[model samples]
Target: MIASSARLARAAGGSRNWLLGVLRGSSYGTASEASFQVESYKLHKLEQGPSTSVTLSRDDGLKMYRQMQTVRRMETMAGNLYKSKIIRGFCHLYSGQEAVCVGMENAMTPDDSVITAYRAHGWTFMRGVSVQGVLSELTGRVSGCAKGKGGSMHMYGHNFYGGNGIVGAQVPLGAGIAFASKYRGEEAICVTLYGDGAANQGQLYETFNMAKLWNLPCIFVCENNGYGMGTSVDRASASTAYYTRGDYVPGLWIDGMDVLAMREGTRFAKDYALKNGPILIEAVTYRYSGHSMSDPGTSYRPRSEIQEVREKRDPITNFRERLLSSGLATEEELKKIDTEVRKEVETAAEKAKTDQELPLEELYNNIYVDPPQGMKIRGCDPTIMASTR
Candidate 1:
């Protein structure tokens, strides 16, 4: 009886040990595994509640609010124009990602240069292009910043380079701009914006190496909106942490939905680049529109997913809430700004729709600084050229 009781007790103890081992798995087998689990839990908590407070003055807050509103309204108007067939040829609206551009613009100096991909209406607006000019560009009118030549994907303004179409192509051009700024010894920085899809290109790393080697004053920003066209970042990129792409260059990751967070983060990056050469910043934002107007935006992502980001993580709405909570703005003040922006956008759209287009003769005029003396231009009836001349 004594032997039987001792054997039973031993069996029960072994069973308990086996259960504990199953519950713990590899977590308790090694110190490193335990430490990793704890670190991951802490990071998850940080993501849930990011530190997003800012100390902007009332005026600055109001200005940022207005800037964000302008971007939203402008993109909305562009969408309408595209539907009505007023704007033609590849219209990409920057509706949901306004905060990344507006907040970064607020932190930049007038002399600083900015460049981005085809989804560029927001940055152009933030870079001092008027609503009328943007709309006119979309409509291909004579009053466009590109003089009715380059359409939506090629608009430009003072100190703004371009709305490049080629993916990952703008990095080297932006580096050249930075090189020029450094060569001239100007207190200016170049901000190069690209999508997560473009992050996988070979040239991006080459640009990074060159930028770091020469210590160019360039801030390479990756707007990781989670999707590269239809492919999710996870599918397209092996490493989704784009801020660390610079490797040698210091990196920053910010909640792109928070205007203040983006503003502060961009300011820090700009200052760092100015003082210590180059830096990389990754803004984790989302795009509400399809990759282009042709897409329905439903193949890879669901409507509910898009709606959640719009409702809860919209940069414009988020900014308004923060401003009101901090006493930086009142509902009445916000409403007044909204009313003015609506009027401005409406007027610009009307002008864009009615504006005159560039004449055919002007098409080949700006291709070169001076036309070649004896160039046989194809499709040019000699009679027509002579008549025009």
Candidate 2:
């Protein structure tokens, strides 16, 4: 049975099965010796990202496959919830950007911090929030992380800052978080991410200036999905090279669709930030859906264009093929993983439906830091009144 193999992969072979062992739970790690290697990589103006033969063990490969599928399934469920009038207001799906999150999260230690723009369900799950927690939050359930208050743009956690609503606002907050880590003498670095749309925001430049001056351990990430809302990257910005925006900070550009490349890019950037101040990375990713729930996502770009990318570079399919071809996992093993992930998502959705929606007065709590991790409400509510909690 595939389940038996998964169990064996985790239980048998001890240290040799390090990554597989870790895969039994929420965490994962890469082997010291790569079971496979990344043949190529993407970089900024220069090739600063990992171009060497980096090891990617079978266990690690399976872990990434599961992670990407989980995110995709979660986002798919979110979209359905939005259509059914459950999740509302400013819902941005990260269905196509799984590799970036999975790769980047796997490359770092638990101490590292991350902050991103509104598209954050994947990152929230990667940072340890459960499918139930994420779905409950989006559904405005009392059990939701942020207690059903933060909704789509305000999820937060231990080392994860938030699903910031402002376009480029999280960039400065990320720098501040890195500054705090540095002030406390912690070795953690902060990864702040924005989309190609927010790449040109004036505050982002200001954050870059301050981060460079203070040598803050911040990794500024530009998830350049080639479109800012409905506008193409070239038309939206004078220069589409987001990595070079941080003139003083060193930069790397990489293929965001490839999870392995993402892992190498983040690993290299994390080390560069800890030792050499801040760094910049523009991950060339794509989003299969509209900018938000309201946008059809087909107005600006041709359907064929998006279809071509899906056919050629869909991150999940690409990684899945690599795993199969490389003999890292069997077809049945992968099917089991997909089945398991689907069941998890469906179970989470059903449970989310039963969760009690937060009351109007629940907003009074968590005005400030009186209590850590306040409640959140799904944006479906038609009205809200403020109170001190």
Prediction 2 TM-score vs. true: 0.85
Candidate 1 lDDT over residue span 215-253, tens digit each: 999989999888899999998877887877777777777
The candidate maximizing lDDT is 2
Worst 10 residues of 2 by lDDT: 1-10
Taking all chains together, the TM-score of candidate 1 against the true structure is 0.83
Model 1, which residues run further than 4 Å from truth? 1-53, 370-389
lDDT of 2 by residue, 33-63 (tens): 2333443454544444675445567778889
Candidate 2 lDDT at 215 equals: 98
Question: Which pairs clash in model 1?
Answer: none
